[model samples]
Target: MRFLLIEDNVQLASAIVERLSLDGHVVDLAPCLADARAHCATAEYDLILLDIMLPDGDGRTFLADHRGRENATPVIVLTARSEVSDRVGVLDLGADDYIVKPFDFSEFEARCRAVLRRKGGASGNRISRGDLKFDTLAGTLQVAGEQIQLRNRELRLFEIFINAPGQIFSKSKLVDRLFSYDEDVSENAIEVYVGRLRKHLSASAANIVTVRGLGYKLEV
Candidate 1:
């Protein structure tokens, strides 16, 4: 999954980014509210890890503005404030979850998964379509009880498809999800990844189909 982490604490942000990247997530870091807003305006994220106390502005205000515009992207507030009112305030402002500072990484990961599952309408980390299974946590794909070997780009592309089975993804959207901000990748790169993924899934029960003028979607 792709995530935006809005935080100013270098140490904590680094640790979180490292851990999430190790778990096969593409994470973008924004040190302040201004940067976070800029990132949010440009790219779509599966989740947002927002710090309440930001260098430029309050994270709560950002959350309020996000919700005021009817954006439904899930957000998890990361803050040192553990007060009841603080938590309630952020939740009321449309945060899906809240994590206190100095919390366990395991718990943090679990919360992220839970929120993602809720957003994706999935019951668990394993997204299954027919005999094909994509394990979000393990970053593995299995077809008919056999594991399939895939490259990093192939795996990421498959993850996006498996997460939202029949939903059609435009080429531009897929490109955005596959590449990071700093990467100088073109839209054609998405086609290359999709072509490779199609070859890899040839023997599987699931397939990737093009939508002509639209883009691509997973067919099971």
Candidate 2:
């Protein structure tokens, strides 16, 4: 998954980027609201991790403006405020969830996964399509009872297809999904990843099919 992490504390932001990266998520860090806004204008994201107290501005105002612009990207607020009112305030401001400070990384990741599941309309952490079991949080795929270990790029590529089974996803969208803003992508990156995923699923019930000049789709 691709995420925008809006945080001012350099240490905390680096830690978060590292943690999310271990799960195969590409995280872009923004230290202030201005940087956040700039990132939003240029690239799309699956989620946004926002810090309520930023260097330049309050994140609540940004949340209001974000919702005002009809940007439905799911946002999880990272706040030091632990009071009930504080939590409610962010939610009222359109944050999907809030994580208090002094929290463990496990709890943080769990909250992220939960919010993503709700927003994506996925069933629990395990999204099932026919005999295929896809766990977005763990970044693992299982066909019938066989577990297939996917590399990071292959996982990201498969993630896009699993989310929207049977629907065509254009190559341009796939490129955006597979690579981060700063990553260098070759012309055949998508095709190479698709071929790898196809080989992995050859004996399984799921398959990926190309729609001549249109895009690609996952079929079961």
Candidate 3:
């Protein structure tokens, strides 16, 4: 999954980004509200990890504005505020979940998965298409009950496609989703990953099909 982390705490943000990346999720960090808004305007994220006390403005304001625009992107407020009123305010503002500061990383990760599952209409960590199974939590792929190995980029590409099966994804969108802010990537890099992933999915019941001047979609 692709995520935007809006946290003013540089150390915390770095640690979270590293952990999420290790778990096979692409993450972009924003140290302030202005930067976060810029990221939101240009990119689509599966989730947003928002801190309440941003350098420029309260994260709640950003949440309100986002919901005001009728944007449905799931947001989990990560803040030092443990007050019931604070939590209620953000929840009423359409934040999907809330996490208090000095929390366990395991709990944080679990909450993230729960929110994503709820958003994707999935019940658990595994998402299936035909005979293929993707272990979202474990970052593994299985075809017909047999495990299939994929490179990091290939796995990331597969995750995006599998989660949104039958939906067309343009090359530009794919690039945005596959790479983080620091990576130097191009459209050709996306094509390379797709080509390799296609070969890996050869035995599966699902196939990735190009849409001819449009993009690619997963067919099952």
Candidate 4:
């Protein structure tokens, strides 16, 4: 899943980004309300991890604006404020969940997984296109009733493609989703994985096709 994290603390932001990335989520971070709002306006995200306090404005104000636009993207408030009124305000303003600061990372991850599951994303962890199916948990692919083994990178690439079938994703976006934020893997690496997956897919390769001037899309 893709997540937008809004927090003014640079260190905490970095840590959260790293941890979420390690859990196979693509995270985009913002340090202020203005930047967060701009990102939310332009990009598609599965969830938003918002901090109530920001340098430019209140997270509640941004939440109100997002709500006024009728945006239904789920939000989880991660903030230092744990007061009852603050919790009520955020939840009533349309946040999906709330996590107070100095919280356990394990709990945070669990809540994230739960929220995503509620969004109907967890069931499709195994991606299917035509006669091909990739079980993300087992890291195994089955084609024409034959099991096909894939390398680590190939599995990651196929996982991303299969999850959002028919959605055109740029090479950069794929790279960001496949690798951790700290990794320096090149854009061309995606092509390499695509080539390998195509070889394994053979005639079924048509399901994963290039979009002119765009990127790649997995046709269901």
Candidate 5:
């Protein structure tokens, strides 16, 4: 999944980006509300990890404005505030969950999964398409009782196709969903990933179908 991390602490953000990237997630870092807003204006994210105290403005205000505009993207507030009232206030402002600072990385990951599952994402970290089994947590595909592993972004691209099934995704859309803003992507990157994914799914009941002049879709 793609995530937008709105935070100011350079070290913490680096840790977060590294952790999430290791799990095959594309993460974009925004040190302030201005950069965060710019990201939101351009790309879509599966989740937003927002810090309440931002360099340019309060994240609570950003959350309020995001909701005021009817953007229902799930947000989990990452802050140092431990007060019950602070949690309630941010929840009232439209945060799906809250995590106090200095949190364990494992616990933080679990919290993110909890929030995403609550928001109808990857149902319990498992998805079954025909005879193909996907374990989101493991980032592996299981078929015929055999586990097939995928590279990071290839798995991400597969996630997109499985989520929408037959919907034809344009190359640009896949690029947006698979690569982060800071990553250097080539013109034919999607084609390369698609080819790689086809090879991985060779033994499975799933198929990645390409529509000439359009894009690609998943068939199971």
Candidate 6:
């Protein structure tokens, strides 16, 4: 998963980035709310790890602006503020979860995973289509209990398909989904990822079919 870490504490922010990177996440760190908002303008992040006391702006205001204008990107607030009201305030401001400073890294990671799982779906954090079950958070594709691991792009393509079910997703939209502002994506990149995911699915490829010149759609 690709994540954005909006934190001003250089030491703690580096530590968190290292930990998350070791756990198989591609992380981008921003020291202030301005940099974070700039990244948000074009980059697509799976989740955002935010700090309340930013150098340039308040995290609450940033969260409000984002929720009001953009896609509902899951956010977990990391702050030194430990008061009951502080926690309530952040949560009420649209944060997916809140964690106080001097926290256990293990628990923080667990909370991040839980928040992502809940936002994605149920059924044991899996997206099912007939005999296939894809564990999105774990990035595992299981066919009748046989597990298969997917590459980053392949998993991302599958994620889009599973999220919409039967709806048609245009190639342009898929390209936008697979790429961040930091990356240069061609129009055909979507087709490339879809082709790779189709090969990975084998017989299950029937579930994802082209919609002629329009794009692609997933059918149960």
Candidate 5 ranges beyond 4 A from true positions: none
Taking all chains together, each candidate's TM-score versus the true structure is 0.92, 0.93, 0.95, 0.70, 0.92, 0.80
Backbone clash total, candidate 6: 0
Better of 1 and 5 by TM-score: 5
> Model 6, range 167-209, lDDT digits (tens) per residue?
8988876766665445677878887877777776676644678
Output the better candidate (1/3) by TM-score.
3
Rank by TM-score, descending? Answer: 3, 2, 5, 1, 6, 4
How accurate locally, in lDDT, is each candidate? 0.89, 0.88, 0.89, 0.79, 0.89, 0.80
TM-score of 5: 0.92
Deviating ranges (above 4 Å) for candidate 3: none
**Per-residue error at 127 for model 2, in Å?**
1.5
Candidate 6, superposed: residue stretches over 4 Å from native = 18-26, 68-71, 179-187
After superposition, candidate 1 runs with Cα above 4 Å error: 149-151
> Which tens-of-lDDT digit does each residue in 78-128 have in candidate 4?
978878998998899998899999889989987876676566465644656
Candidate 5 has an lDDT of 0.89
lDDT of 4: 0.79
Task: Put down candidate 2 lDDT per residue, 56-121, tens digits, no spaces.
Answer: 889999999999999999999999999999999999989998899867999999998888788778
User: Which runs in model 4 stand beyond 4 Å of their true positions?
Assistant: 83-85, 120-157, 167-190, 199-206, 211-215
**Model 3 TM-score, 2 decimals:** 0.95
**Highest-TM-score candidate:** 3
Residue 187, model 3: Cα distance from true site in angstroms: 0.9
Candidate 5, residues 1-220, lDDT tens digits: the string is: 8899999999999999999999888899999999999999999998999998887989999999999999989999998989999999999999999999999999999998888777655658888888788876788998768898887888888878877788998898888888877778974999999999888788887889989999999998
Q: Residue 136 in model 6: shift from native, Å? A: 3.0
